[model samples]
Target: MLAIKGVSRRFGGKTAVADVNLEIAPGAFIGVIGRSGAGKSTLLRMLNRLVDPSEGTISFDGVDVTALRGQALRDWRARCAMIFQQFNLIGRLDVLTNVLMGRLNKVSTASAVLQLWGLEDKAMALAALEQFDIANLAGQRADSLSGGQQQRVAIARALVQEPSIILADEPIASLDPRNTKVVMDALLRINKHFGITVICNLHSLDLARGYCDRLIGMSAGRVVFDGAPAALTADAARDLYGLEAGEVMDADADVKWAGQARPASAAA
Candidate 1:
């Protein structure tokens, strides 16, 4: 569904992403992991044209995404929705209203500003909330919800757009363990049930291994590994993080928010 070839991004002299190549098939759940400055977020943003590549090309369903502009670009972005680490909801708006904002591209700016107060949009928004199990909070202000609830609402908002592909950049970064489970479960369920293509940037290897069908590891702005989650090893992880296998194993045995638990066979 998505293909990135020889993609590179530079901010002035600093290259955030370099010569990255990846292909995502329909209904695939792919996870990207890397250190703080490894360019995972930059790569995710480039998928939907949030950041145009400094060099190389990105294509979606065979259409060259970097070449898109004007209405064409907007239309393409609508098909590939993004979820941020922060739940980017309007604080004052009701949860349902915030979710309905996903449809803004389909409606006029005036209508969206007024929230298109009608039964149809309301029904669609409520259905989206129901999917995320936040239907009861539909009328409440976005700011009133807990972190987990807010994130679920944000997912609902993205789902409301009926996007063919979802790009989530550290979606569960701020949640506790239990909340992380809830959010990851929701994402997994969506991928399994709806067959939506999901590519997410995650910090935790455990979470990526547990939930994603495939993992892509990055270091210093380049992809170092791309394969099934089961293929990852302590040695590979050590190389990715520039640590010894023992050091990587010793630090934080407990699962971090998005961390994956090592499989029995791979455990040290």
Candidate 2:
């Protein structure tokens, strides 16, 4: 379990996140929804220690996240992987090489710097690519692929890390609708099939409703609502966004608001 207690983050004089507390069970697919500058990104960053909280504690199982340093912190980062909106791949590197970077923490610094991957490491990276149906693109440059394909490569890289948790910060924000579906489907598959806990920051309420098992609504750096998608009413959405939920409902026409059980085929 991931436990966050009274967490807060401050940048200069302004607070990015304030007094947040949450207990996330293992294997959960959680969607974090909020308007821009609502501290959604800050919250996720704090989990992986990319950004340290000014106050409170974050724990995974019994480990205290705040006190970790050096190699321990690096190990923690490997366990709690982060997926970014920009896909963060080395544009000039081949897809397979980029995926192999996930093993940096496990390998010696000299070997990693020299790019000396062994046959087993290469096989693991290839297997991760094949799991995402992108093994054929292993030899291709990461920048040469489409947005959806690049994102899949990013996911494959995360898979090679063998993370216990995945924190995606607005992962589909830059993609078109078709690419959005593809990336979201990949995340859903990772969460359901691998039993890895996923917490994604999303701009679209409909996508959150369709893909996430639980929705966490934030407003002005505070959590406003936490529950199932069906329980999030139009009024509650309005609280998150000044605009009514109806205006956003059409963003993804196929996503229903009634919180029906997502079909297995959706992830497949």
Candidate 3:
């Protein structure tokens, strides 16, 4: 289980996430839905130590995740993989190379710096790509692939980390509807098949309802709702998103909360 207790993140004087608490059961698929700047991304980053919380503690199982340092922090990050809105692949490198980068914490610095990955490591990276049905593109440059394909490669990279939890910060924000389905399905498969916990930041209520078993709604950096997807009614969505029933169900409405510019797949 992942436990977040009294967690908060402050940017200068502004609190991005505030006094939040959550318990994530193992292997659960959770979609965190909220307007932009609601601190959805900040919450996920705190789990991976990408950002330190201004207050409170986060623990995985019984380990003190917030206190991890140096090698311990790196190991914690390996155990808790993160995927981002941008694919974050090394654009100049081949897909397989980028996936192999997941093993950096486990491998020697010399080997990584020299790009001297062993044949077994190479095979494992290939296997990860194959798991995502992208093995044939392993030799292709990451920058050459379509957005959906790059996202899959990113997931494959995370899989190579053998993480217990995957925190995806708007993984589908840039993809079209077709690509969104592809990426979301891949994440679902990873969660269900591998028993890896998944916490996703999502923009589309329909997509969140369709994919996540549980939904967490955030507003003003606090969790306003947490329940099964089926319980998120039109009224609940309205409260979460400040949208009326028609706008909530439009499916193609711009949900750029907090006046942020919508992504290319704003209609997603």
Best by TM-score: 2
What TM-score should be assigned to candidate 3? 0.92
Question: What global local distance difference test value does model 1 have?
Answer: 0.85
Deviation in Å, model 2, residue 258 alpha carbon: 17
lDDT of 2 by residue, 1-268 (tens): 9999999999999999999999999999999998889999999999999999999999999999999999999999999999999999999999999999988888998999999998989999999888888999999999999999999998888888899999999999899977887788889889989999999999888788778889898888899899988888777788778864565555454554245444353332
What TM-score goes with each of the models? 0.91, 0.94, 0.92
Clashing pairs in 2: none
For model 2, the stretches where C-alpha displacement exceeds 4 angstroms are 244-247, 255-268
When 1 and 3 are scored with lDDT, the better candidate is 3
lDDT of 3 at 36: 82
Per-residue C-alpha lDDT of model 1 across residues 82-101, encoded as one tens digit per residue: 99999999999888889888
TM-score of 1: 0.91
Stretches > 4 Å off in candidate 1? 244-268
Instruction: Report lDDT (Cα) of residue 5, candidate 1.
Output: 95
In order, candidate lDDTs are 0.85, 0.89, 0.89
Runs in model 3 lying further than 4 Å from the true structure? 244-268
